[model samples]
Target: MNKQHAQHQIWRKLGLLSIVMVLLLLAACGSKDNSTTNDESNAQQQEQTTEQTTEQPAAEQPGATVYPLTLKDDSGTEITLDKAPARIVTLAPSETEIAFAIGAGDSVVGVDEYSNYPEQANAIDKVGDTTTNIEKVTALQPDLILASVTMNTQAIEQLRALKLNVYATEPKTYDAVIEKIKNIGVLLDKQQGAADVADRMSQVKADIESKVASADKPSVLVEFSPGWTVGKGEFMDELLTLAGGTNVAQGNGWYEFDSEQIVKSNPQVIVYSSWYEEPNAILEGINARPAWKVIDAVKNNRLVEVPQDPLSRVGPRLAEGLQSLAKAIHPELFQ
Candidate 1:
């Protein structure tokens, strides 16, 4: 009976050991499954991160101008160039300003008398203004001649007759002016410089529009000369529109408006070019006019004087002109 009891206790101990071993094996298998799941999750996270990096967009780069490049001028005349022009002659102040602004100032060997904004242009040889000297232009032996279709009509014709490369421009709107600048840049192989100028002008325009978006557009009259005002289809007219003002002049292009017509329009803002003779006297004359006394601009003394070069020349400085007009028309928003 004693031997049987001892054998029974040994069997009980063996049973307990077997149960502990089984529990340990099950815990090992569970740990292995959990480790495998964690590895798979880590791999998936890394793959998604790589895909996001690969989907990023590349930065834009400036394009190179291919030579023997042929393009149409603002005058709608097609011109071809064998290579970048080394010697250039500008027949207008706007062209001179554009050439200099595009980093091709050194290439300008001759310029019109009015191209005086960049001190460098003033140092260059003067070709002509209103009427270009054909002999002087020929003597320069320019590879490229920049002219204005409107300002240098006869000069362009004469130069072209002489078998010279004359690229004429006549930008009527603000966007047209910017496009002209970019086009000039391409001709001069200064694409990056032109792009920079265009970007700045666009930024200024965008900023002004954003500021004046909610404001009311005031009635404005831009008198570059006595009795002379710009109407629709001109950069000045577009500048007024962009500056948040309504041009009071009637008809298209530049024209003379009678005192009676101006009185009827009754513009809220009177913007006159500084190029006018006796600006102070002119302002005084407008203020003293008894008929114009009822006009809001005259009554409130809202006469703003802007530099003629920036406003008149459809060049890089046109952006400056736009800002000045905006400040004059919407003083509160700018402030």
Candidate 2:
């Protein structure tokens, strides 16, 4: 073989080696690029998983929305009242009525059975009748639970265990009732309505005072179911005072006195109330008892029966109750 031909053959073999090396380098570069892309994708998926896990903690708690509330309760369990409650439940009719007056009736989820007024109250779930129903109340998931000192106490305690905020109310007189109404209004975010109601009540009181000056001041005896008598501090006593009458009873509060005591007092006028109207209902009671039969008011047939609406409801109509009392004391004065 010639020397030049041998040199040519060597050069061709080197060229073949160089081409194989370039192909191997390209294959290695592709594998590395694929590995890097896979790593980046896996990192992105892991980051998404972390964000999903972090979001779960936020879901565990309630959202940050504060409502305003003013809690006024005398004798009940302690509660952490942070803000106003949006949804409320009342275990007593009095509290429910107060809520209605404050314009928070729409937010009420449960009410006592005695809250039969306004017809809409019937649409809400019944907690009890002037009482409490713990299970039903808790199921409502109310942010606030309103009760009365004079109402069922056991259920209030049971509700507290469920971490519900409770407020108990007591209003013995007109002034206290106004204050209560205002506080309830604040709790339900009805400050304006409450103020208006209080202002109106004050005006009504002032008007009653003006009207009462010319009326005959009679001595009165108020009786209720099962022979209840009004004493000092009772709403009836307050009404009588406004109506220019003297409620002749002991202690000036509410009580159940013996028939002999009522007969002996011998009020100039006797007032009777019942769930229903039957003239004999009041007449027979006094007739059956000889002591009452001889009383001056009874002998003179000076007993009066008031309509169920104005006499029973202690809400806005309480002002009307006082007016009725004045009319009964002196019909000519009202005219």
Candidate 3:
């Protein structure tokens, strides 16, 4: 009986040992499977990381796959440039100034009569006045042509009829003017150069605004012509606001005002453009007007004369014009 009991105990011990060995072997197999899965996951993650690294540069490349550009002009005309313009013709003085500002002056083959700011623009072949001489423009063989609202519609159509690339620019606001400069830069492949000029103008504007923040805003009037004044929703009005003044013109668009209206507005300052070749003579004429004598602007002698082109032409020099207007309106602050 004792031997049989001893045999039973040894068998039970052997069975327990066998079960422990089996459990250890199963654990080893499970660990191997988990290691294989982790290795596969790590390989996939590495592959994905490599793919992302390679694609980043191609996606972020500037101006790549963006050539042969297509865009719409202010006139809603579609224009496509196969590449950067080699030869450009500008029909407006403002457009001519913009081309020169963007460092594309060398490519400007022809310009209108009024493009006289850069000195270099005057040296270019003249294509006529705002009317645009089609014959001379055609002779220039320009790869690109820029026009503005001042250009006659018939002349613009004639240039377009010749299958010449013509972009009409008529920026109604100050922001629009900067956008036009940027677009012109992109077209000329001088994007960085254009951006630099635009940025500088922006800085100039900000600086002027900061300096004039606490200035006393006085009522002002801009007599562009004898009896004409720019109303609300125009660049002239914008300039007045920037210069810490108020435009007394109430109507929308350019309109004629009589002496009675001028007296009623009672502006504190009257700003005129150099449009009149003889600015002094024009100011004298205004000062001598019997009805204008009653107005505060004439009595106080706050008739400020600003350069016509810088204020009139919506181009790179717009900031300069704004600064000049600020100086004229708030001379004390500027000084």
Candidate with maximal lDDT: 1
Whole-model lDDT, candidate 1? 0.68
**lDDT, candidates in the order shown:** 0.68, 0.56, 0.64
Per-residue C-alpha lDDT of model 3 across residues 240-316, encoded as one tens digit per residue? 79888988988765555666888999999998755424444446658767988889988898999876557656678
Mind sharing the TM-score for model 1?
0.80
Model 1 / residue 304 / CA error / Å:
1.1
TM-score of 2: 0.73
Residue 283, candidate 1: Cα error in Å is 2.5
Better candidate by TM-score, 1 or 2: 1
Looking at model 2, residue 11 earns an lDDT score of 18
Backbone Cα, N, C clashes tallied per candidate: 0, 7, 0
Model 2, span 49-96: residue lDDT tens: 111211112113212222422233545233444565778997655566
Top TM-score hit? 1
What stretches of model 3 exceed 4 Å from their correct place?
1-65, 279-281
Q: Cα deviation of 93 in candidate 1 (Å)? A: 0.7
- What order do candidates take by lDDT, descending? 1, 3, 2
Model 3 CA lDDT for position 143: 90
